[model samples]
Target: MNKTKNNFIYNIITKDLKKCKHKKIYTRFPPEPNGYLHIGHAKSILLNFNIAKKFNGICNLRLDDTNPSKENKKYVNSIKYDIKWLGFKFYYDIYYTSQYFYLLYKFSIKLIKNGLAYIDELNKHQISKYKGNFNNLGKNSPYRKRSINENLIFFKKMKNGFFNNGKISLRAKINMLSPNILMRDPILYRIKFNKHYKTKYIWCIYPMYDFAHCLSDYIEKITHSLCTLEFQDNKILYDWFLNNLKIFNKPKQYEFSRLNIEYNVISKRKLSILIKKKIITGWDDPRIVTLSGLRNRGYTSNSILNFCNSIGVTRQNSLIKISFLENFIRKELNIKSQRLIAVLNPIKIIIENFNKIKEKILIPNHPQNKNMGKRKYVFSKEIYIDNKDFKEKKTNGYRGLTIGNKVKLRYSYIIKAKKIKKDKNGNIIYILCKYYKNRKKNNVNGIIHWISKLYSIPAIFFLYYNLFKISNPENKKNFIKYINKKSLVINRGFIEKNIKNINNFSYQFERKGYFCLNKNFKNNNIFYFNRIVKLKNII
Candidate 1:
């Protein structure tokens, strides 16, 4: 491990290991494959994967794909793809909790035989009422004293698809009056008649997440079962199941707070509803931060992994600003991505007197990186300036060229718009300008980005904004009520001819935004460039 700038959790784990306390560290990311993975999942992935790597240990890609009601093969595959994309290489085989269904069932039966577990015949509401408080403890189940043979017979029928969903659950026979309510005979298995993707209809009963989680860890010999803070309350029962099962090398669960992002809700249910209602395009909607979504919006995997490392691991909850992520992406791209020009909202600006150049002018792709090299672009007498860059009325910080004002065309000549053309709708259609053609002294506030009018590349520029109106609305409330209706405002514009030669997957539209190739790109390319944040505080 490159022990460089000491990251927080690494230091702790390093110190702990130096003491010669624990053997080779083993970590696992056990996600329930219910929905698409998000940035929060990225944090967990980095934490677990990094821990294993830093200690020369191992990490397991274990899917808690037990509940067939919500799980699917598609989600399972996506989870695998995402983990690989984030640069994690796992050791041993990928394990699923369903793989342990037979062993888990046998263990449950053994518990029943030992008077350590029993079949709770109570309905959902009755079970909830009896599952009591942290300090007050729980009321005992009426059927807690059923004989092992009788419980076994009912449970066998349960496995044979005899019981309806929620009709019966195999529960651990822990303390009813225990202060820790999770251990108050928690449900170990439940009847879900739905066919599992992996197991099919071989077993009707599915193991609970808590039951399957620790058992799978022990079975895999995971030294550390890393989890989020929400699972801390369930640790009492986590320990109970391991002790009851008498599994060797029981994995100890350590809880850390899951990541929360501003203006973005991380709940899978909320994201699903948003997609269903057409609130956003889909899970990867650029506005939402799913892995595919981030990739679509041009976030590098390296930046995401670095962002996770920058955040580090901690038990304390963190509310990371979306800026933190944006910074890293920009940082990575600054060295990697070339600078090109594409004006999103366009107004035609003409040079009244200038060299009638319609051919390509070679410009360095990225100024800092010579290895990225140079490409040719069209510089013409007539071109497009952002409509917003020009105004009939002027404001205080307005540095752009309005009518009769002089400004530099980037890497070219300074020009002044002498006249303007307007359509029937009173929209400014074109600008007539005079260019200064000296071997020149620098002039104009800035060379506000300009695109060639000739050798046109049909690129669609995007002024992407947040999807949510409220940064953080109240929980489970009508978040959709605050959806930003104009999150995406598209503009058809032209870029320099050099950009026409750019490999479509990634490109920068200089002062305008960052763009990538659309999967459905054609010769008459429809370029989709998301505003990679704003050009330094335009908002």
Candidate 2:
């Protein structure tokens, strides 16, 4: 268990422990297995698991598989992998809402016998009409007056698949005139003929989320049911079920603001649409904020956890800038990632005065950390520098290579451009330069990163930008129209050849940016790199 940080949730747990409300604290992260986990889910995972660890309690991983029509084994497996990748351990074997279906069914029967619930024959539209909005009070369902025996028979028949989908539903017998619309006879269970991923065709009637969530927590003896603020209103329904059922080990639900980042869509429904339309490669597309996407894009688990912790648990909802999260990875990679020189747009620089065919130059893997050691690279007369680093016509304050101006090659000697060779299109093919050995570092106009043309390895780079052009696309009527066409740009680049253990480490590509080997093509002949982030922050 890691040292727990103080936060609003932590404060609540402390007060509970001091009051001896319970001997041990229990929490659970219950996600519907409908889509891949995203950054917003990361906040909840860390909060629930860490809260349990802080108090020497246990946190369980539960799949809220109530609506199997949208759930599947693929998502269940992905959820497990993500939670494990985030460095959390569930209390025992992974639990599922489907595992408690029998118990939940019995509880529903008890509610029918207790006259707290009834079977309604109204269709979906009629149910909505009866459950009026805040402007008017809801009218009681005609079937709300059915006897307990009659409601029990109808519920049992519905459970046995006698009723078609949406023909009949079991609704809790709550006040129809209550100002809280959700409590106005909410649906407890409905008929769904679709096959479930886990239970298959064993049953037809599945319990609704509001009916199963609180009971599942009670069955697992969960003490803290933490969810996002959207559930603040649903908390009443969550409590009503537990109270009416008279469950002994009742759990309390707590609401916290969700993690919403600027320029990104966090909703699962919208993400599914993006995938279905092939706008993204998949759930793991590097441009999105899904956990798998971030992992594939070279974001460390520590960096993500640090970001989640920095945004403390609170009740106030607000949008966070994406750059704020980028800063965490930037700071982390700055200290940990090795530095390697790479040239994105190679422009040849021929050392005319060099006599030696080739030589070895040693550069530190990390500038600040001496213990990280150094890497040796072959230096030749011919080298490749970024085309943007040189100019035929010198501009004001441009410190890069220019005619008659000296610039230092990083970790090497200072050189002055003498003349340039260009193609028929007036493009500078290469530049001729003279090198000066043992020159003072400050003597050069600027320093630039370069790769030996002879020994450099060719690699493809994928540069990622925000998926949406605007900061908040959620406000737009057609969010897809605002999709950024330049979200992903590909560039061919070269890196030092002697980079050992390349697959295991991320590298700061000298002055360009931090990059890592693309996991999709790790074993391929050609190397593929993903630009994790730039050296400096950009919106």
Candidate 3:
């Protein structure tokens, strides 16, 4: 069952179950194996999987790999990995559209024998010229009246690889002047001589999406065929093929608005373009919203699931602010992530009056959750604090160090700035300070986080921001032009020594945001972390 609050879709499923419309509800997430699954897909994944679990039904993960030109095993594997990472398990083995290719061809042959389909020799351009737009009416193809025998013979030849690509296609015999442009003699199958990733050279003709999708559902006995809003127009064609073939236990198609987040485009086509052009690193680039990208960026499965639930399902399309998602992640990590001090832009602070020896302080892993226990942090005479924590001269409401100002060290003692040192260029080299033994609870000056410079771990930090500067970059003529050049900022930093080999864990960098260790830097001696999100909006 979905542990989160219910949505409209769940209510519908409940009604169906009460009426005994289905003996067992079966759902499927059918994605084409052309690109990595993005965060938008996560919404659908959760909807299908959770609904199935809620009703004690089974959900199948099906790959719609009908188009071999852009499909490959790599994409198939990635799609599977992403779904699993989101904490879903398919009731059936992973299925593919290629599995029922021959069966679909038989169904097409039956449609031809029944005078419901014909082979047209029109090229793509000519076909488009005939299937008119919304404001126009379509003209019938010249080959529309071919006898069933002749059409069957031609389609068989097409399957035999006798025709060149785009030389011929099979179209359903439907209204040429239907109100819906999609139902106006839509093509059922097209000839493509490319080798398939799974079937190899056995097939030259492939069923179109409308032809394959509905029948695939019927063949699998899927009870609900959920799709994005773009497929709303195709529902007539989807039912057309099934009604024409008269398949039993026909699956019904339902459409819902897709997830759209501001400051990012989730279209697989645009994401692929970014990858091919090398504008971003890859499909798994942390800046990307791909499921793998989110996973690599340290977004937890529970947080993502909660986010999908929070948004709820709706028929109307709208853009959601990305900060809502960040807030969810922040809330989740605040309870789960350990509190650790990491200074991305460090300035050396020497405890001039200290005993010049290392001291150990026990700090709670999480300030709010004491049961998480504590870890030992080494406090030393030479320590590093964020450079931003110091000011040359005091401002009206400054929270950090200034001449003669006292501040509290987090989980430690109070510190008073005594003096500062600089080099030839007038840049402050270090700030000299003295530490007190007592912990101050009422100090007006803000508390700062720090790590011992001598015992801390050196690390490279990757700070991320929105991939595009514009909130709606997709609306632009060239979205790449709006790419945020400073999306990634690299910094050298220091972390506590106790964090060794715990790269899988995330940490709260004190006043800074949440951070997760980078997998690539594990082998190297130095640590590397990616900034998941800031503690709060700075502005």
Candidate 4:
């Protein structure tokens, strides 16, 4: 059942725990709940949950929901759905940093009385002025000299909603000369009047990430705080907070490089920008990296888990070619997904001078998996094939349908293109063909999957392309300039009659791709199927 069996990482983790005398290891994936979790989040999710499962421990799905400005109930709900879709189960103990607001507030009081923290009335601009470049010592805040009593009283009113937004912040009284800007008197709390989806408007001040995250891990007794490479620099601050607070079960922060894909944007801010600029649709648009987008496009959790395992954990920051990930999906789906015949680009061909009784074709549901059984398709005089399948002239490696070229209709007899009809616009509306009496496999240069004209299944094939145009769409640079104009090219077409009853949940249009039945499937079953990726190239 395990794909990456006996991997070194597992052995290493086991040995480390034994040395530390850590009986049970606890890990967590703390997303901010601000945006739909993307592929990067999927990596972190699998790392946390799968590692816990491997070691017979628990992994908490904590909503690092500290930033109220960018978070919402919708995003929180989406995060839950996505995590579950990826095959994770969490208890009612599911937590939000907001849930610990009072506890965090009390903790802040502890720091204040200990002189480890003080409230500074420096607005953002004033704070930045004192926060010198890492090489230079940050100028101290004027309020740094405020007496403990005055600072505590002001902090209480700030907690009680006395401070306007951005007026003041609770800064950890760390070294202002620290080389790391994040540790150079990092802001622990800020005043925001926004309504939290979970806490509502009860609290005016929210704990900043560095403050709430470390405390949350400590409170939950998390053994390890797994994060992406972006937080590697913040490890110092994480350690300082724990060491100074003298937390008994201080969890260590370990960072791994976040997985990035070519032609994909994983940043929440950039994703929001894409939506706002109308470069793409909403977060769940199939083109987006959100789990909902992948779900809509027919990617299963098993496939995703397998894909993540194949990549493994690494310290190096690298952007993997999208092809590598897509390839993994294709490999798994090809073996499991049932195959059907669906034509995305249709061109009708009518057999002339050969009138015969209605013919039915029995096609194997799956080539190797016979328990899946077979289904019947119809054979009629007039059938539509792909236009690209046929060519009036041959390309470099042409073997598909072409003018006067005889091609087998896959599981049926051979047909030769005879004549074509065009409207006033001079476009081939349809092609006329003649059928060979005794056709067998390998009798011709080309054989293609096709649906019968008389008993065809009407389907919509929504072909998908990569989400972005640039190879590294997740780079810190601007992404608006790299919109892939052809990200989603919608095509409505038909498949063989036998495919009509096939389970729409997961299917592969034989020699085409993996796809899912769209939500709008109706009585006619005029469903939409978004191609997960081409079966061959994807894996």
| Candidate 3 residue pairs that clash | none
Candidate 3, 1-539: lDDT as tens digits: 24344476787788888999999998999999999998889999998998899899988899998898889989999999989888898887998999999999999999999999999999999999998888899999999999999999999999998899999999999999998888888888998878899999999889998899999999889998888898998888888888788877788778888898888988888998898899888988999888889888989888888888788787889888989989889998888888888888889999987885888888888889999888888888999988888997889888987779888888887888888999999887889998888776576488888889867988889999999998887667688989999999999988888787354378998888899978766745788899888888651
- Which residue pairs of candidate 4 clash? 326-538, 327-538, 327-539, 390-401
How far residue 376's Cα lies from its native spot in candidate 2, in Å, is 2.0
In candidate 2, which residue pairs clash? none
Instruction: Summing lDDT over every window of 10 consecutive residues in candidate 1, give the lowest-scoring window.
Output: 1-10
Q: Which candidate should be chosen as best, given TM-score against the real structure?
A: 4
Best by lDDT: 2
In order of appearance, the predictions have TM-scores of: 0.91, 0.92, 0.92, 0.93
Question: Candidate 4 lDDT, tens digit per residue, 12-87?
Answer: 5687788975788888888888889888888888888877888888889899988778899899899999998887
RMSD for each model, in Å, please? 2.9, 2.6, 2.6, 2.5
The digit string of per-residue lDDT tens for model 2 on 1-539 reads 23245477788899999999989999999999999999999999999998888899999999999886899999999999999999987779999999999999999999999999999999999999999999999999999999999998898899888989999999999999999999999999999999899999998999999899999999999999999999999988988898888877689888999898988998888999999999999999999999999999999888899999888888899899998999999998998888888888889999999889888988888889999898887778999998889988789998899999999888888999999999999988789999998657876789988888777888888999999999987667799999999999988878777664555568888888889889787744457889999878422
lDDT (Cα atoms) of all candidates against the true structure:
0.78, 0.89, 0.87, 0.81
Provide the clashing-pair count of each candidate structure: 2, 0, 0, 4
In what order do the candidates fall by lDDT, top score first?
A: 2, 3, 4, 1
**Model 2 poorest 10 in a row by lDDT:** 1-10
TM-score, model 3 to reference: 0.92
